[model samples]
Target: MKPLLSIWIMLLCGIAGRSFAQTKTSTDTVVKPPVQLKTVHIVQYNFFKDSLAFREEYAKSLTFRRLKWYEVYGGLSVNINNLYRVTQFKKNKKKITFKHMLLNKEQEMFVSRVYTPSLVNKVTHLDGDSLQLFMQHYQPDYAFIKNASDYDLYLAIKKEYEAFMKTRDSIPVQP
Candidate 1:
């Protein structure tokens, strides 16, 4: 029984010694190359000034490992946090809101107006208040231009010309 126990202990020691020797040779013979880090630029645009800016320290060189989903999510979160830093916000210690951060009065007004393609087309056509004053002086020229042979168009032009002349006549003449 004593000899058998002694043999078991000798086998365990031999296995442990072989493992240590293998680890040492593997570590010594295999040289790990120095890590090559790449630099990344973090850019942010200032909407009010219409300019872009970047930080030297924040855009430092980095070493990237495998691209994991969680790491990608974390990177996006960091980018959002950096973006928020550039914007102006009104906040107390208890609460914060981002409504006023990247917006000005003019931009807010523009955003408030829901501009559709039809509205843009109408604006391009010179309709509404803009054309009201012009229309008072001259009937829309397009009606006469497109249908030059029509007697009604000719009458309309004649009427507009007379009205414009009458308004001119009404103005007091400077001698």
Candidate 2:
């Protein structure tokens, strides 16, 4: 009986020691995702609402598709400003910055409520004909071509258009 008891204790100690030794070393390595894997492109709508509304409401109001979510809810914006070093959309954690998103009249009005009156005047006054004329005649300067805001681009084209009109008016009429 004593011999049997000693054999059982030795067997139990051997099994415990083996289990402890196996756990001391880990072979697994930590893997990290690539930078590109985190970013996703989405065709966000050009919608802005001051109050909290359903996402369905935003979807309904969508006039055009853009590559980003615009500032709509002030609380969300404030929370973003407080929590994140960079303001990102609630849905995705991508960096938020201005992109050259075209705005229809309604969208323009929504944005212009926060923007300057001069910008509203400049943007609202330019019709399709003016846009076509500007595009046809205006060659923006190299400096103006790069990293220009929509407002800056419009102002540059409008200035060029006005210059072209002045030149055209000065040309003498052939009898």
Best by TM-score: 2
lDDT of all predictions, in order shown?
0.44, 0.49
Supply the TM-score for candidate 2.
0.22
TM-score of every candidate relative to the true structure = 0.19, 0.22
lDDT of 1 by residue, 23-58 (tens): 785447777799999989988634333312212222
Candidate 1 achieves a global lDDT of: 0.44
**1-175 in candidate 2: lDDT tens per residue?**
9999999999999999999888876565457686665667896443344323433444434432223234333554544543343233442222111112221333444443433334434654645544444443454443444457787767765676567667755544432
Residue-pair clashes per prediction, in order, are: 0, 0
Question: Which portions of model 2 show Cα errors greater than 4 Å?
Answer: 1-121, 141-143, 147-155, 167-175
Instruction: Return the TM-score for candidate 1, rounded to 2 decimals.
Output: 0.19
Which candidate wins on lDDT? 2
